[model samples]
Target: MARPKLQDVAARAGVSVTTVSRVLNNRGYLSDELRARVNAAIAELGYRPDGIARSLIGRKSGLVGVIVPSVADPFFGELVAAIENTLADRGYKALLCDCQENAEREGEYLELLQANRVDGIITSTHNRGVSGYERAELPIVAVDRRIAPGVPMVRGDNRAGGLLATRHLLARGSRAPIMITATDHAGNDRATAYREVLESEGLTPRVHAYGYATPIDERRAMVETWLSGRRRLRPARRLPPRRGGAAG
Candidate 1:
């Protein structure tokens, strides 16, 4: 048999389709009597609102969009994979959007996700400027980044990590140690914390923000170069080799 439509439910309830829609959307001011009648009619007809149909009417898609700056980075690749797996387990599918660090492309992706009726979004560009992300009306969760207002955030303490790195360098008796970091909107937070701790101990902090490659080995090589440069900057002011010190 053909399934009942919302109009059928509304007619059975002696109400208008608008009223039925209001009841379904939880919109409008409905009296208790009308609300009960609508629900009872819905139960009697065994009618279910077609999510796809409603999305068409409401201009929404029942998809979740996930935007990552770059999936080539192992950290983001692993994070996206885990999120996708979890969502799949729960019977939800995800739309992966890779922006490749292009702000214009990121904005376009957000628009595209919305136009496709995405119910929600997850973003890893929280560490960067998020004005485009903030404009989206869908429920957004920032993974490894935070920018949208009232959105749930999931990540580690960047400031604390910076402090730990600074102290570790200082403990190694490297007074003029330099920090190598990526150039991002959030990168300064760690560098700021690093500076505060070093300045407190009457030491200067050097920060290098360039040449950050995605591959782990390349990143390690870049870090090594930064460390070597720091050593040359202050070959005389050195601390003894740290062996499980307080900072370590």
Candidate 2:
């Protein structure tokens, strides 16, 4: 059987195609009786409007692209979930793309989203120095990552948070607290604030930076080695050797 169309619904409802369109789109004044008849005919025929056809006419795709570094990461996962829920409430659908922190993959996803003609994009992936992003001609909201000029950005107060943490650690009797962080220029503000706070207190600031591209096990080993070295450098506390045990 042929699928039902607007013309079929109009004929079954004893109305013109214009009337059926008005009823479907809730445009113009419609009598309750006529609305009921058209709705009943649509229900009886199981007629559904084609979204793509409607979008083309309205010039609104009603779709939003969301690109993140990795949804597997808890922060990005929660952020995406919140954005999706907000978009759903606004009757917009989200097309999600996880770039997995790879720049090439991120670029590919951006192109894919543009090709799909999404209404807008919410991106948490970096696009610095990447071409084509500046030419997308779409409304883009950047989350935590800096992009081309004129692109709006949303970010947290990293510097204030870092200063607060460092001050708390100093108050808690940490003589030489160090700030450990990934070696990303995006986080330079936090490191700067940490150093500033230490300098304000007339104490030297220690910092340990690690590469994010390193494997997790290798990063952990590096951290362990740094901790061991710090421990070795600390002043030794001497205690009497045990009576019946090996002495030092």
lDDT of each: 0.75, 0.78
lDDT of 1 by residue, 70-176 (tens): 77777778888998898888767889998877777778888888877888898876334546665677788887655766779887888889888878876887667
lDDT of 1 at 171: 81
Estimate the TM-score of every prediction: 0.63, 0.72
Model 2 clash count equals 0
Model 2 error, position 54 (Å) = 1.8
* Candidate 2 residue-wise lDDT, 1-248, digit = tens: 89999999999999999999999888999999999999999999999998778777877888999988666555677998999999999989999998766778888888988877789999987434556668898899988767878889899887787778887887897756777765545547778877776666656666887644455677789889888787766432334433443211
Candidate 1 overall Cα lDDT vs. reference? 0.75
> What residue runs in model 2 are displaced by over 4 Å at the alpha carbon?
1-3, 175-183, 186-188, 195-248
Q: What is the Cα-based lDDT of residue 22 in candidate 2?
A: 95
